[model samples]
Structures are given as C-alpha cells and as structure tokens.
Target: MQRPNYPSGKDLLSADAVSRFDLDDIMERAERHLREEEMEKAGHALPEPPAPRRRPKVIATLFDQRSTRTRLGFQAAAARLGHQSIDAYDTDRNRIGQTTGESIEDHIHTVELYSDLLVVRSHMEDLPYRVGRLSYLPVINAGNGADEHPSQALVDIFAIRQMRGPIETLGIALSSDTRARFAISFVKMLKLSPPKRFTLCCLPDAPLNPAMREAMTVLANLGTAIGIVHDIRQTLDHDVLSIQMQDMSKFAHAALGNEAVDKEKESEPFTLTARKILDARSDTLILNPLPRFSELDTSCDSLPNAGYFRQVQLSVPMRMAILERMLLGIPWTGQADSFPPSSGG
Candidate 1:
C-alpha cells in the first residue's frame, strides 16, 4: 500500500481537519517509533532520525485554558523531533494587540509572523478553526472548548491500536460521562477506524443520545455496530473499556457556595471492578485518560491489562507523529493494507 496522502496545507485543527487518510497511517508510524526506542534501549544500534527538510525555529503552544499533559507532551515531542516548543498564552486575552482592540484575524496573522506552527488550546468552541483559516502556518488544536481534543484522540487511537492487533473489529466501551470532550473527540476519530461495536454507557442525564444515534448510521456504513446505554454493566462484554469522569457543571455552584456534594458513591455506576474485568475475555484492555477523578478506581490501576499509563507513555510518540506529520517529516512502516478486513455485521 502507498503511504497516506498528507495535505499540502499542513494544519490539523480537528480529527477530520484534514482528509480521513487510513487511521493506520498514524498508528503504524507510532508503532515503529515505539519499537525503535525499545531496540535502542536493548543496546541495538539504529540509524539516526532524519533532520527536517525545512525545520521550524519554534512550535508555539498557545493555551487559553490550562493543561498539563497536552502542554508537556508537545514540548517533549518537539524536543524528540529536533525542535523547540514554546508555551504561548495571553492572560488578559489580549494578543494581536488586544490592548488596541485588534480583531482575532489580525491577531492570528500576527501570531503566524513569529511561529512556524501554532498548537492552540482555547476556552472558546471554534477558536482554532478561525485561527487556522487566517494563519498560513500550521494550526494544531490542542483542545477546543467542549467539542474536541484532536491530539488526545490521536494518542488514544494509537494506544488502542498498539494494544490490540487491529482496531478494526474490537468491541469498545465508552463508559462514564459520554459528553466529555475526550470521549467526543475519540468517537469522532473512530469514524475513520470504526470498531466492531461501540457501547456508550453514561449517567441518566447524558446528552449523547441524538448526535450519537445519528453517528451510528455513519459507523454502520463503515461496518461497525453501535449501541447506547445508561447502565454501565452493559459494557462488561466489550474488548476495551474507557471510564470517563462525570460532568461537573451542575455541581460547581454548590461547591463554590460551600455546599458539600458527596459524589464518591455516585461514581460507582461506572467503576470497573476486578471481578467485572477478570470475568470478561482474559485479554480485555482497560483504558482511561487520567486526572481520573472518581470514575476509575485505584484497584484497576495495577491490573496487567490497565492501559492508561501506557496510553500516556505513547502520547510522546503520538504527539511526535502529529507534529512531524504537519511540520516536519517522520518515517512510517507502510502497513496500511496489511490490517485485517474489519469483521462485523
């Protein structure tokens, strides 16, 4: 199979921001990167990584909201790729001469003048979209409001594909809060690499029903089964389970007003007990994106199948692939066609 076609204008603002190339394009590259590291660790000599044909002076990571993993991961990725990552932010919401009441378009233009690529995280819903529109440089969205976190989705799919042989037909459970930005972004990526069955089991008040019901049609066209449920136990049969922290918007006011809200037991609905996991298929993979809150219990962490830490470990290479794809160039193993044909009704 030919290497995937990357677009001429190299900006990735969302999961489908560029063309939906084979999802294997991302995963296979990450797999090779990981293997190269493991080989080097075992005292095997390897060829040096190629320097970029056109390297950037700095990758500006602009954050309108705070982040730890996204910020630090990109920096580590940049360093590995032979580039510097700069943390760029505006505390007063004033860039492009915000003191002069400058427009966002002009601000983006000004931003492009200084940086090679813009990795942005915004409190606003579509700030990265507008920025990518105006700036000639690459605009890689770190996260955008409640809608998407494209890089997180990239790292996530990479982790899952590595753990399992092929992402094609795995039954994946999206448990806990279905409305979290991480879950939404991940599901969007799944459109390109549809699993055999996707089960979204959330709380009683989850708003994922209407939109996800529609996505089921699209996923079905790509040969994946889909189901939505409020009962978390229904996910016990899945090959992979990701438990997300519940949404806390409604309870924020109570906590701010000094009203104690007891939410620990409320989290029991989605917690993955050892019994639930052990009784499933022996190879079942447990996934979580952490700062876990109460959704993922501590007991699950030491389980051999727990993939969250390895998931975080893979983000370095995942982000490296993301940045290098858009900015510099990285090598791929060329295994897109080798993936098994997706199996499901």
Candidate 2:
C-alpha cells in the first residue's frame, strides 16, 4: 500500500467503468475490515487485515450540486481507507472552476495535480465524462445529472448479492421513476451481471428513457428474463419471480395472492405495500432509488424484502472499496479481470 503503481490515464466516471474494475476484490477488502472489528469485540487475537501498509491517498471532490449521502459518504470512506477527501467547492457552493470561469477539463487537470482521484457531482450528466476526457486521474461520478449515479448502483448491488445470492439467482425488481438518474444508474450496474430476472415496475406505458431501455436490451441479450410491469399486482406474478428465489423459496410463488393492494392508494406514480409483497413470492426483493415522496409507502420499511435502505448504510463501505482500489491498489488484480481497456484508448 505504498504510493501505489497503476496504469496511467485511468478513470471511474460511469457504470461501465465501475463494472470493469475488480469490484469483487474491492468488496472482499471491506468485509475484511468489518471482520477485524467483529473479532476485536469477541476478545480474540486480531489477525492481520488485508493490506498491512498504511500509505495515505488524497481524493478531490467537486460538486456543482448538493448531496447528503454521497458527499459525506466519500469523505468517510476516504478516512476508513487511510486516505484524504478534499472538497473542490466551498460551503457556499463556490467552485474554483465556476469562480474563475475555467473549463471542466482544466478543472479536472488542476485537481489531478494534487489528488490521487477526483469525485465529481455536476448538474450536467456529461460533465464527468468531459472531465475524464481531460484528466488522467481516476474520476468517480457521485451524481451526474439525470443520466446516472454509478456509485449508488454499486452499493445496492453489493448489498443484494450478499443477502440473496449471486446476480444470476435473484429475481430483482426496481420500482418508482424508471427515468430518473438513480434508476438508470442502478439498472445499468445490474446489467453487468444480468440476473435471472429483472422487472421495471412502473405505470402503464411509462416512458422508458433511451439509456435505461438500451441497458434492458443488453440484459435481455445476456439471457436474463426481463419484464415490464405496470400494475403493482403484476409485480408479484409467478413469471417475474419464477427463476430466482433461493433465499425465499419457502414462500413459493405466493407474493400477493392472499392480500389485496391498497384500494385507496397514494397519489404517486407507483406504490408497493407490505401486503402486496407478502402475498407474492416472499423472496422477491424490492428496490427503489430513493428521495421518495410517495412512490414507496412507509409500510414496507419494516418488511424483510426491502433493499433500498441498506444502500444508505453501505454507501461508505462501497465507496471505501473504490478508494482502496484506485489509490492504495491493495487488492491488485489484472485490469482485464473487471476493467477492460477503454474503447477510446
């Protein structure tokens, strides 16, 4: 974990880039960190955690927008991984680039001179890519317009794989605004290891944004049984929850058969209550890219099938894994293992 050695001109600005990195190796290191803490509580001899060296790395963050989970999460993760997180913006939302009328390319270049990596959350979706195009340093897209939030997608996937099983064995369904950036990013990451089943739970003829639709096509080509459900009732159907129920098979395909959907529903576009979920395959996991107004009722918070809330708890560890991979290079694996050579190269 000395000043690490890695390929020059690499960056992490999109779901495709995140998919290429050794996510599995990164995650293993996080689990190692947690295990060390558990062992300490048991009054047992603590075995050496994965990386022994403790060289510190610096991460520069540039946010044109405000965020609670992502901004604080990156900073916390940097400390956990023995790194630094420096904000490129001030408390008043003042950015050097904005104050000086500098181009994003130049802004990225300036930060690369000081930090090991850059985390950008911009109002424009393409801005992260623009920065990556100019800077050789690794760039993480914290929240990029409405196009995607790749890191959030990473945390959700990691949590799901842990509770259920592998990606190939889960019948995953995402609800709420399918066209939102969170939804788009989450679905794209899921496509990296297309699951046994995926359903977009939305209203009738809900507009499928081109970005999301393309991702669905990719999963379909990869052999995942993808479905689009308009009604809350259809979500619990046998076909959608058929292939992957290894963890909840005892409930079988009875997700919502016994219960009735709320006759008096919320004034939201989509709603999933505990009753509907319980009557369906008890194993079908419900996910929502949050900031929810009413799309997801509060009633489901206590249910066993909810995975969205865990994403918040996992934001730090997932971001910590990214810092360790990009900076310390602790769990070094070949780029080809997860990261393919960039097409532009």
Candidate 3:
C-alpha cells in the first residue's frame, strides 16, 4: 500500500490551509490509523506503530511563558515518539531574546539548522505569526499569549469524544483556571457547528482571560450563545461538560460561598458532586483539564457516568495520535477524502 502523503509544515502558512489541519482530519483518519497501528507500545498496549518511530529532526521548545501540562505534555509526546526535545528557556540559555535582542527570525533560522520543529509559547498574540514568517521548520503555538492554544483545544476535544458520543450541539461549562479558559474559548470559536451554548462559571475576580475572549469571537460568529455567570446552576440546564480548571490562586476561595456550603461558614459548593449533577440530569459528564481543586466533589467518582478522571486518562491516547502525526508528519488532510460526503459540509 502507498504511504500517506502528509502536508508539510509549510502548508499552514495560508488561512485556506485550515481544511488541511482541521480536527476532523485527525478524528476520522489519523486517529483511526494511530489506534489501529501506530500508537506507542510499552507497558500500555501496543508499542509504537509500524510507521517510522523517530522524528525526522529535533524540536526546540522556546517557551517564553510558563506551563506545567503544555510543556510536560509536549515533552512526553515527543519522547513517546522517539523524538528529542531541546528546552530553550532564557535568552541566556538559547540567546534568542537576549544578547542584542536577535530578531525572532534570526533565532528561528539559527535553530532550523538543528531542529525539525519549534514549539513556541509567547505572551504576544501575533508573535507566533511573526516567528512563523521567519522559521523554516514547523511552528506550534503552545500558548500564544491567550489568543489560542490549538493543541489544548485538540486534546480537550479528544477527551470529550472519548467520554461522550457526539458534540455538534454539545454544551460545556467552564469552571476552570484562567489558563484553561482559553482552550474552551477557542473550541467555542473555531468549532464548525460550535457548542450550542457555553457557560462561564468563575468567581467575579477570576473572569475569562484575554485569549478566552478572542475564542468567544469565534463562537459569536457561529451565532452560538455564551453566558458569563457567577454561578454554575445557570449552565447545568444543558447537556453539560464541566471543565474544572485548577489554579492555586483561586483555591483560597474554594471554601467560601455557593449553595453547597453554609453561607455563614467558610465553605464552597461541591461543584462536581453526584447530587449536583443528579439535580441537573444523570447523564451529565464531568471534565477537567487536570490539576484539580476542591471544587470537584469526590462523591461523583463512584457514578458510572463520571468522566473527569477518564478525561485525563484519555489524554494519553489522544496525545499518542498527535505525536504520531507531528513527529511522523502524518497528513491529517486525508479525512476530506477518506470519508464519504456528508450533507453538513
């Protein structure tokens, strides 16, 4: 059989190229292949698939920002696929941001000689585009200053797909850290159908971040409804996926306010309790981006439909497919051809 002719990283330079990178491309085609043949084999189930194990080159992680899951997840994904990850933290370390302030272009050009890809996390929204203009290697915006975190969105979708059946009209409630809010925001924006509706349930002080707002723009274009409410009850009315984002800064208030706890005392509601979900509907699925706080009640764990922990477990396989594609350079575009025509398009 002929091997898949995947699009090179250079193909992403055009906005029209999105059809080439759409998640459906991964879900229908790449994911099937990875699950069937290419997933990493170890103590898990299958070893690495028959496809080439090692990446054609190295990836320089130029993280100008901080992250635990994004950074570590990428590193873990790269290693699982037999790729090398070079951590370039400071200009003192990589000399890109310091020492005469070498242009990002120059730094990218310099690194391209040794690396096959660049994973960048910047504070500026347009920085990825500017750097992409200069780099010859594939560029992944790890978290481009809240404008977008496509990879996280992809993983979140992957988790949802595993836990629930379909998402065309799926609704999600975000009760997470500001960082994770961007991922939910992007999903609302870029989704072809977008979520029917989404709710923002955070303390008044911990509102959605700037990038989250950008994602909301995408949802707005789709005419998808969005509500920014101080409470979760407003959102539980829908077929909900609760994304509990844990930020240490917000943990202090976890014990205060809300109906689950007595207002006279310092206690918060059990956001993910079975009782809470049962009040809404039994099928309500729980989701968390990981590193959780006390907001999610432990009682939900015994319920058959409880899915947050399963959401975390699903990340391994979803990431396995992503690593196979990025490192092996799988062309996710095949779905446009592989599946029969659908009326939705």
- Cα lDDT tens digits for candidate 3, 1-345: 332333445322222223424567656543564464333333345543346754445767877765677777777666655677888556335555565566666676677678777778776556666656555456666665544566665666666666665666677666655555344434543455467777666666765666567666767677768777665556566665565633433332232113242222112532566777778665767676655556666787887776766665555555555555555555334221222122230
The order of the candidates by TM-score, greatest first, is 1, 2, 3
Q: Could you arrange the candidates by lDDT from highest to lowest?
A: 1, 2, 3
Extract clashing residue pairs from model 3. Answer: 40-47, 41-46, 41-47, 41-48, 146-211, 176-245, 189-218, 189-219, 255-267
Clashing pairs in 2: 20-338, 20-339, 254-279, 254-280, 255-279, 255-280, 255-281, 256-279, 256-280
Against the true structure, whose TM-score is highest?
1
lDDT of 2 by residue, 1-345 (tens): 133343443566666664434566656766665565468768977665446447567889887666678888899988867678898755354544465576555566667778888898876657777766566567777876666677877777767765566777777776555556666777777766778888876656557779888988998998988888766657664322211111111111112224432323343325566777777645466555454444567787897767666656666777787776776533323321243234441
Tens-digit per-residue lDDT, 261-299, candidate 1: 566454666667776666664556878776566666777
Best model number under lDDT: 1
List residue ranges in candidate 3 displaced over 4 A: 1-17, 33-56, 90-92, 99-103, 176-181, 188-190, 202-228, 244-275, 278-282, 293-306, 320-345
Better of 1 and 3 by TM-score: 1
Off by over 4 Å in 2: 1-9, 18-21, 40-45, 49-55, 91-106, 237-269, 279-283, 329-345
**Positional deviation of 86 in candidate 1, in angstroms?**
0.8
Worst 10 residues of 2 by lDDT: 242-251
